[model samples]
Target: MAVPGWLDDTRTSYDTVAVSYADLLRDALAAEPFQRGILALFAELVRAQGPGVVADVGCGPGRITGYLDGLGLDVLGVDLSPGMIGVARRDHPGLRFEVGSMTRLDLADDSLTGLLAWFSLIHVPDDEVPGVLAEFRRVLRPGGVVLLGFHAGDGSRLKTEGYGGHPMHVHVHRRRPERVAAWLEAAGFTVEAELTHRPAPDVEGGFVFAHR
Candidate 1:
């Protein structure tokens, strides 16, 4: 099948800003106490299921990937942007990073014990989310954990610039937690947890912890 236009634009935009993006968010997780707590909790959940590997889907520059690794889950970082993967490998030479997409992840079924898509689904359109969630389910082992983070609310916007004011052409989407939970259920995932956080007056964060 032919690739979608938005995928190309998103890939190009991230490739254009990969280094600056990496630099901007390198130390970001340290300040995010809630994100850290949940990640640590997630690592525990996966470990409790016995030994297995985890994939950080849409891993960006591998910040969360490294954090999860520190928490003791064997980690693999995958992203839609090669530039992002390059920076990931450069910054964390000890870990594995690959160029891949959640729309169609390049992995075998039931291959992962855990999966993370941190704020990466914000770029995907609403119509595409179910397919992406299905892909998530396909790669995860039965009872495996999946973590998803994204902007919370309704509607979408065209992100024209970001990360040190570099030009970007990607759509940023926001969805309510309930809606996402419904999608997860429809995809044969059991929704385990739902969290919403507000970083600013107008910004709401959505996180869903689910199991396949």
Candidate 2:
């Protein structure tokens, strides 16, 4: 099957800035108490569902994946950018990182106990999000959990540069939490919780916790 143009563009854009991106975001969790707390809750809930793998979809540089692993959940990192995967492997040698797309995951049906798309959905076009959400629902077993983190707003923005002033070619799409929750519901997930926080003055971050 042919890969989507937007996915290709996003992969290439991240590959170009992977090293700088990893360096900049490696310690991101240290300052965000809210995000860390939410992730802890997610890990605990998913682990309670029984032993199964958690795919950290679009897990850039594996920081979040490592954190989840520390919480005792079996986890693997997946990303579209090979460069990002390389950085992830280098940063956390013991964990697994693979290059893959969220819209069409390679895992077997009902194989995952959890999926995390932390700020990774922003690069997916609005029209394609439902399909990606369905893919998340497809891979997860019954009672599996999904935690999505995204920027809160409407419309998309062209990102011409990224970490360390590297050139980038990607569109960051922002959506309201209600809209995201609705999409998850349509994709067969029961919305468990919704949280919003302003990590920075200009950034309105949104989170949706759902179960399959």
Q: Each model's TM-score?
A: 0.97, 0.97
TM-score of 2: 0.97
Give the range where candidate 2 is weakest over 10 consecutive residues by summed lDDT: 1-10
Clashing residue pairs, candidate 1? none
TM-score of 1: 0.97
Alpha-carbon shift of residue 3 in model 1 (angstroms): 12
Give the per-residue lDDT of model 1 (tens digit) for 101-142. 888988999999999888999888878899999999999999
Best by lDDT: 2
Q: For candidate 2, lDDT tens digit of each residue in 89-195? A: 99999999999999899999999999999999998887888899999999999999999999998878789898999998788888899999999999999999988
lDDT per model, in order? 0.91, 0.92
Q: What are the per-model C-alpha RMSD values against the true structure?
A: 2.1, 2.2
**What lDDT, from 0 to 1, does candidate 2 have?**
0.92
